[model samples]
Target: MKVLVTGANGLLATNIIAVLLQRDYSVIGLLRNEKSFALEPHENLILHKGDITKVDSYDALLPEIDCIIHAAALTGQDIIDYSVYQEVNATATENLYKSALEHNVKNFIYISTANCFGFGSLDDLGNEEKPIRFPFSNSLYAKSKLEGQEKLLRLAKDNPDTKLVTLNPTFMIGSYDTKPSSGRLVLSAYNKRVLFYPPGGKSFINVIDAAEAVVNSIELGVHCESYILCGENLSYKEFYQKVTKQLNQKSSYVKIPKFLLYGIGYIGNLLRFFKVKTDISLTNVQTLCINNFYSNKKAQEKLKLQQRSIDNGISDAIKWFKLN
Candidate 1:
């Protein structure tokens, strides 16, 4: 099968491309700039320079593409404009879906974040059926992705022939972090004497595991269905301890109180109001103070997704960081 993956330079997309090549599938990676290409050259892997937000950039290539893993997204809490998020996360998705249909692309796998679903406590984990919850609902990034998911689902209902699968992954950490996206979490506490973290917990997964699930979705995923690809649930304190243990470093873990985080977020809001770019808003801070946990039972049953130890993920990330 010939596959096209967007955000080719992103941590997840890079891993996905590696998996596809290992499975003997031909790949076309769509990236905005050729100079930013991170993957090594391969006989079956072809890199294309294009913009995902603009359909014409990749319209001509869609004819021969059998499956498209739309992994490109505008992510970050720093951006203050919802329109920017909508353009990349929502409008781009709609345009790509329409073009895929016109070109008869059979499988379209969208990569969305778990924040689109309501998070639960350790006792009751969030699932695919949950609605958008607080803090995340206020997040422009999550709201935009949710908007794209809804549009794709609605479009899929009328076009039954094309299989549309959405994979919602939680905090992913592993290798190929050229931009060092999620790896920042690990880097933030690396070799530190004291580690300060929010009081909340989250569902974490290895990027390789998440990438495997994305490839598996092409063959095993059901149409118009969504899966939450998650792994072990750990609080901030527990996670930092794991990081310390993996790095073989001694560190004291301190949990930031919710009030303090909120206060910081208020300051961030003021900065944004004054046209400054910052990621410390109340929404992002509130997200850090809650148990944003999720379940992978659906993905396990449907896509045969496997859950790996987050320790391995941390180790890989640390090793990669050390080298790169």
Candidate 2:
């Protein structure tokens, strides 16, 4: 099978491409620049330079492509504009699906965020069926991803022949994070004497496990269905301790009060009003204070996703960060 993966230089896409090559599948990686790609050259891998939102850039390659893993996304809490998010996350996704249909691409896998679903407490974890909740609902990034997921599912209903599977992964951490996207979380407390963290916690998954689930979705996933690819749920304090332990460093963990976080968020809002781009906001801080936990039972059952210890992910990220 020949697969086309967008955001070829991204953390998740890098790992996904590696898995595809290991499984003996031909891959065409679509990204803006070939020079910034993270993966090493392989016989089955081909890098194609292109813009994800512009379908015309790689429209000709769609004919021979068997599957497309749409992993490219405009993420971050810093962007203040909804239009920017919509253009990349929502509009581009719908356009790609339409083009894939025209070109006879049978399998389309979309990598979305777990924030699309409502988060729950440790006792009751969130699942694919839950509706999105506050903070995340107010988040432009999450809202945009949900829009993309809805559009794909709606389009799939009319076209039964195409297999449209959406995988919503939680906070992912592992190696090959060239941009050091989520690896920033791991670096935050590494070798630190004191670690200040938010009171809330969320679901986390190893990138390798998330990549494997994406590949399994091609054969095992049901049409128009969504899966939450997640793993252990740990509070910020607990997670920081794990990081400290993995790095073999001693650190004191401090939990920032919700009030203080909200105060900082207000300052962030003021900065944004003055045309300054900042990630600290009321909604973003609120997201940090809640238990944004989720369940991986659906993915484990259907996609055969294995829940590896987050410790391994932490270790791998630390090793990669130190080297690169």
Candidate 3:
């Protein structure tokens, strides 16, 4: 099998590439720039440099590719224009999906986020069947991803051969955390420098575990299926404790009240409006204070997504942090 993976420089993509190579699948990584790829060379792996928003550069290679894993995106809660967000997260996905379909790619694995579900602290987990309720229009990142998901599902209607599989992961944590999604907190806690603890719950999946689910979906996944790839449910406090323990450090963290955080966040927003840079963001207060545990029973059953334990993940992270 020939697999083309985007976002080859990311933490999850590293494991995906390694897994594909180990399985003897020909892997092609679409790198935005060649300098970012520093891993040891592999014979089965090929490199392609191009932009996902433009299909012209990959027009020649698209036809021969068997599978395409779309992992490229600018994912963040920062204030950015809708047009820019759509161009990278939505428009780019549409272009790639269309090109993959036109080129007869067998399976298209789309790396999606569970954040598209909505804003809430409820323990309600998201799955394929649950309807999506986008919380806000200003949710440029979430809205774009949801639209991308819709596009892929709709494509399955006319093109049954081009299967679409989505893996919705919550706070991914583990090795190769170069971009360090919430995992860096492990290091921060160990260093005894985690300034504040957000009052919230977030479901986390190991990066390697997420990679395993991606490959498993390619091997055996349902069409138009959205699998929530999550693991142990922990509050921000518990999550940091894992890190602190791994680092062999005991640090006391005081949980700030939600309302107090919002007040500070509002000040942060005000500061931003006044062209003053502050370490706070009012828009991010609710996002930081909500419960976000997701269930992965579907992925566990279908993809056999065995997540590496949070302890193990934190251990690996500590080692990586020490080395880096």
Compose the digit string of candidate 3's lDDT tens values, residues 172-289. 7766666665655665675565446988877877777888889999978888878888888788888887777776676887898999989988887787678664446765676667
Q: Candidate 1 vs candidate 3: which has greater TM-score?
A: 1
Off by over 4 Å in 3: 118-124, 133-138, 193-195, 271-280
Please provide TM-scores, in order, for all candidate models, with all chains considered together: 0.99, 0.99, 0.91
Q: RMSD to the native, candidate 2?
A: 0.7
RMSD of each: 0.8, 0.7, 2.4
Model 2, 265: alpha-carbon shift in Å?
A: 0.5
- Candidate 1 matches the true fold with a TM-score of 0.99
Q: Model 2 off-target regions past 4 Å?
A: none
Who wins the lDDT comparison?
2
In the range 140-212, model 1's lDDT, one tens digit per residue, is 9999999999999999999978899999999999988988899999999887999999999989998889999
Residue-level lDDT tens digits of model 2 in 15-40: 99999999999999999878878778
